[model samples]
Target chain A: MVPVFLAQWMKEKRSPYMVLIFISISIAAALLFGSNMDIKLKIDTFRGEGVTVEEAERWIDRLNESGAFIFSLRAEEESLADVRQGRSDMAVRLLKDDYRIIAVMESTNVELVQQHMQAVYHEEFRIMAAASHAEDELEFREAMKTYMEQPPLKLQSSTSSGSELRSYDMRLQLLFGFSLFLAMLTVGFRVNAMTAEKISGIWNRVILSPLTKTEMYLGHLTYSTLIGIVQITMVFLLAKYLFGFSLGHSFGMLAMIVVLYTMTIVAMSMLFTGILRTPEQFGAIFTSIVPIMPLISGAYMPPGTITNDVLLFIGQFLPLQHALDALIGVSIYEQGWTDIYLPLAKLLLMAVIFFGVGINLVERRRL
Target chain B: MLETVELSKSFKGKTVVDGVSLYLDQGESVGLLGPNGAGKSTTISMISSLLAPTHGDVLLRGKSVIKHPQDIRRVLGVVPQEIALYEELSAYENLQFFGRIYKLKKTALESKIQEVLEIVGLRERQKELIKTFSGGMKRRINIAAALLHNPQIVIMDEPTVGIDPQSRNHILDTVRYLNLEKGTTVLYTSHYMEEVEQLCKRMYIMDHGKVIASGTKEELGRILSSEDTILLQLDAYDDAFIEEIRSLDPVRQVERTDQGLKLIIAKQSRVLSSIVQSAERHSVQLINMHVHTPSLEDVFLHLTGRTLRD
Candidate 1:
C-alpha cells in the first residue's frame, strides 16, 4: 500500500499552485508563535480626594513590587523636582498623603504592568494583616477582607489570561481544514472518473492490464490522501512555526489524526462514487454536501458556538471536527491520551463507517 | 480462447444485451457491427469483465469468467469508444500511470512505456501533454496505453470515431499488424459498416440490444441474395414520377437517395426497358442508371427497413 501510494505520488508530482500554498502556509505558521510583549513597575502620587492614606501606601508598595519604581516624597515638605530629576524611573507626587499607582512603560507593557500591580497589591494586603497586631489585625483583616472581597468597579485587564479562554486563531486552522476539504473533493471526483471508466470504454483497457481493482482504487485513493496530507502538513508546520501556535499536541498524534481524517475523506469520496453517475453529477453532489460540512463540523468556529442541535451532533460525527477538537484539547489544556480518548474513538468510528460505505459503493457488483 | 455463453444484461427492467453467445479462438479477429444503441458496447463491457451480465457467463479458455472476471480481465485489453486518455498528463505519464496500475515490474514498466510510445509513433512527443495533441494523436496514444500491458485479447469499441482518414487508416493498419503479426485475438466493435467489412473475418450485427445477425461477411451477404439494388439518377423528377417508378413490376423495394432514387429488385429481374418506359411515361429526364449487387447496407435495409444510423 505504501509503495502504491508513493508510486502514484511520484507520477502525479505536485502542481505549482500546490507548492505555492505550501510555502505560504509555512510562513503563516511561523508567524503565529513568535509575538512578544514587555512590562515594568511604577507609582503615582496624584491621589483623588476619595483616597485614604493606607490605600495609598498599599498602592505605592504594589507599584514598587510590580511596576517601574521611581521615587516617593512627603506631601508637605519633599520637593517633587528631586524625585523627577534622575532619581527614579518615574516620579510620584504625594497628594494629601494618598497615592495612585502609575507606570511609564512602553504602550505594549503598560497593560501588563498594571495587571501585575493589581494582583500584587491584593496578595500583599493579605500578607500584611497576617503579620501585624492581633486584635487590630483581626479587625483590620475583617475590614481588609471585606474590601478585597468587593469586586473592582471596572476590572478590565486584557492580559489576564483567566478573563478569556485563549483560542488559537482559527484562520490558520481553517487553511488546513480547507486542505482536508480539497482531499475529499479529489476523492469524490476520482470516484466518478473511475465509475465512468468502468462502464464506458476504458474499463476493458484497465482490466486487461495486470492492474487489479484494488490497485487502481488504491492508486487513486493514495493520490487523494497524499494531496490532503501534503496540504495539511504544509499548513500545520507553517501554523506551528510561524504563528507560535502551540499545536498543543505531539507531532505523532497530529499525524495520526490527519491520517484518520483523510481515510474518512476517502470513504466519503467512495460514497459519492457509489451514488453519482458522472463527474459532473459528483461535483454537484459534492458541492451540496461540502459547504455544509465545514459549517456543521466546526471547521471554522468552535463546536459549542454552532447552534443547531442536529448540526452539532453531526459535527461530533465528522472525523475532521473530532480530530480538530482533540487537537485543540491537547494544545489548550495540555491533555494527554486519557483526555483524548473520546474524540479519538469517535474519529476511529467515523473512519470505519466511511470505509464501510466506500467499500460497499466501490465493490464490483453482480449485475 | 474466450467466449460468452448466453450473456445477457438488463437495466431498469429493459434488456440491453439479450442472449449473446459468441466465442473467439486465439489470434482470431472478430467484429461486432451494430447500429447505434445496439448493445455492442454493453456486450464488450461484460466480456471485458467491467460490467456483469444479468444472466449467463463469460468463459475464457474454458474457465468461467463470470464469477472470477479478474482472471479474465488480466489478459484482456479494451479501447473504449470515447477518448479515455487523461488530458492533464503527458502521453508518457499517462502510459506510465496505466502501467503502474497493471502492476508491471518497475524496470519492465519503464521499458514498456518506451516501447508502446514507439509503437504508437509518439515516442518523440511522449513528453507533450495529451491535451496539446491532435484528435488523431490522442487516439493513437489512447491505443498505445492499452497496448502497454501486452494483453492477449484486445477489444476496441468504435476506436476510429471522428478521426482523420489518415489516422483512421493508421489505426486500422496497427490493429491488423497486432493481430496478424503479434497473434493477438481482436474484438472490434464499430457502427461503421466499412470498417467491419474490411477488417473482421467474422461479424455480429446487433439491433435493439440483441444479436440479430452474426456470420462471416459472405455469410451475412447471403441473407439478402434474393434481391439486388438498382440506382436511377434523373436530371428532373417529381413525386408522381417516383410513385410511378415504385409501381414498376420488378421493383421489390424503393427508397429515395439524395441525388436519385433507389430500388431493390428480384435477383432475376431484367427490367431496363420497364424502368425506361416508366421514365418516359412520367416524362422524367433520366441522367444515369446502374445495377449493383446487394451490400451490408442493403442487408440492414432488408432486415430493419432503416439505415444503419437509425
Candidate 2:
C-alpha cells in the first residue's frame, strides 16, 4: 500500500499535468477573488427640476444607509465618462422633465447596479409628481427616505451565544463557501488519472504483481485525500495572505471540518472512478455535475437567503453546504466544538458511507 | 515451471480461449504465435493471471495459480502489447516504482533499476521522460520495467510490435540473454512468426482461440514437407482464372492474390507443365515466380488457411 501510494505521488510529481492543475486551481482562486474584490456598487446622482444638490444628497444618504453600495453625486458628462471609463459603476442624469441612466450594457454587475438605482430614483420621481407643492414634495421625499431606511426584517438571535452576525461580501462569502468545490476540482483531477491508468497497458502489469484489490483502492484514495487537503490548504493560505481573510479563533476546528469534508469529496472521486468507464466519461460527468452542486447547495447565495425549504433541506445533506456552514460559523461567528458537532459528524458519516461504497464498488468492478 | 491446464475463457457465451494447455520449463523461451484476434494476447493474459480463465486451472511449480494468484506473481513479469508505462516519468523513475511494488528495498531496488537500464542500453539517458523517447526506446523501457525485480518468468505479449528493426532486434537479444545468462523463463507471444522461430525452441500456433499446431520449429515446419508452395506474380488474373489454376494436375489448393495465385503442389516439377498450360488456357500472363523452403508461416497458412499476420 505504501509503495503504491508512493508510486502514485511520484507519477504526479513528475508529470506536467500536476503542475498544470496546480496553476489552474490557483488561477481559479485568484480569478474568483479578483472578481469579488473589484466590484464596488457606485450610484451616481444628479439634480433635476426642484431636485437640488441638497435634495439629491438626501436620497444618496438614504441609499448609503444600506452599506450595500457607494453613493455619490456627479455632473452628467463627468459621471457618464466614469461609466465609459469603467470607474463609476453607474450614473444617472436628471433633467427638469425626466431622468436618464448611464451604464455599461454588457456587464451583469452594471445591470444589477442599474436596477437598484432605478428602484430608488423611480420612487422619488413618483412622489415628486404626486406631491403638487414644494413642502409636500420635500415631505414626501423625507417619508420615502424613512421608508427605505426601515429594516427589511426584525432582528432575532437563533444561537444562545448571541454573536453579532457580520454582513459579508456576497462574492467573498461564496469564494469561501466554494472551498469544497475548489477542493473537489483537484480530486476530480486525481480521479481522471486513475481512469487513465486503468485503461493503459500498465494496469495489466500492475495486476500481475501481488497487490490486493483493497490496497489498490486505498492507495489511490489516500493520494486523492492528500491532494484535496493540500490544494484546499493552499487556497486558504493564499486567502489569508492575499485577501486578509481570517479563519477566526477556531482555525484548528475549521481545518478539521475541511479535512473531513475533503474526505467525503475524495470518496466521491473514488465513486466516480468506479462508475465511469473512461477519463473522458469522468470529465463529461464532472463538467455536468460540478456547477449543479454549488447551484443547488446555495454556495452562490448568502446564508438565510435560501428561502425555499426544499433547497435548505437538500443543503443539509450536501457536504459542500455543511463545509461552508461549518467554515462560516467557526470563522465569522467564532463557533466552538459543540456548536459545529452536527455538521462535522454529518460530514464524517457521509465520508464513511461514500468511502465504504466506493471501495466496495471499485473492488467488484474491474476499474 | 508454469503450466496451464485446459485454460479457456469466454465472453457473452462466446469462447475466446478454448481449452488450451501449455507449459514452460525453467530457463526456456516459449513462443505463442497467432494472427490478429487469434487469442494470443488472451492466452498470455490468462497465463500471467491478469485475466481469470473459465473452466481451467493454472499451476506454478505445482501450486494452483487460480486459487492463489500471488504465488506466481512474485515470480512472473508481464509486458503487455501496448506500452505499459508512465510516459510522464523517466525510465529510472518508472523502474523504481515497479521495484518498490515488487517489495524490493533500498539498495536492492536501486541497483536492480540501474542494472536493467544498462541492460536495455537506456542508462545514459535514464533521466529523460519516456514520452520524449521514440517508440522503439519506449518499448525498450517497457521491457526494462518488467526486469527490475528479476522475476523467474517474463511474459511478453508482442512487445516488439510497431518498433524499429534495431529496437526489435535488441528486445529479442535481451530476451535471449535473460533466458541464457540469467536463467529466466520467458513466455513470448508475437505476430511475427520469424521472431518466434528465432527466439523459441518450442512454439504454439493458434487461430480462432485454439492452438492449431504445437511443436519445435523444425517439427512444425514438417507439416508443410509434402507440399511445395509456388508464388506466381502476374500481369492480370481473376477469380475464374484462380479456379482454373486450382484444377491443375497435382495442385492441392489455390489461393488468389493481387498478381496471380499461390498453389500448393504435391510435386513441383510434375505440376510446372500443367500450371503453365492452365495459365495459357486462362490467358493469365505470369510476370515472375518463386519457390521457397517451408517456413513457420507456411505451417500456419497450412493449418489455419490464413497468413500469420492476416
Predicted structure with the largest DockQ when compared to the true one? 2
lDDT of 2 by residue, A1-367 (tens): 7766887788777764644566356546645764766566667877766777776777777556553577778776787788889886667765554556666765766666566657766766677676765567778777767876796877676434676666554554555656567667778778667678877776667777767766766787788888788777776777677766655666688689878988888877777777777889888997688767876677766566578888778777678887887887787777888988898888888888877886677656664
Residue-wise lDDT of candidate 1 within B1-310, one digit each (tens)?
Answer: 9988999999989999999999898998899988888899899889887777899899998888878777877787778777876676788877877787677788999999998877777889998888899898888988887887788999998888888988898899888888998998999998888888888899888888777888999999999788889888988888888787778787877877877887888887888888898889888878889888999878877777776777
Instruction: Enumerate the candidates' DockQ scores in order.
Output: 0.27, 0.63
Against the true structure, what is every candidate's RMSD?
10.6, 5.3
- Candidate 2 has which clashing residue pairs, if any? none
lDDT of 1 at B214: 84
- TM-score computed on alpha carbons, candidate 2: 0.85
Which candidate wins on TM-score? Answer: 2
Candidate 2 chain A lowest-lDDT run of ten: A18-27
Q: Return the lDDT, model 1, position A162.
A: 38
| Candidate 1 TM-score, true structure as reference | 0.74
Compared with the true structure, all predictions reach lDDT values of 0.71, 0.78
lDDT score, candidate 2, position A298: 76
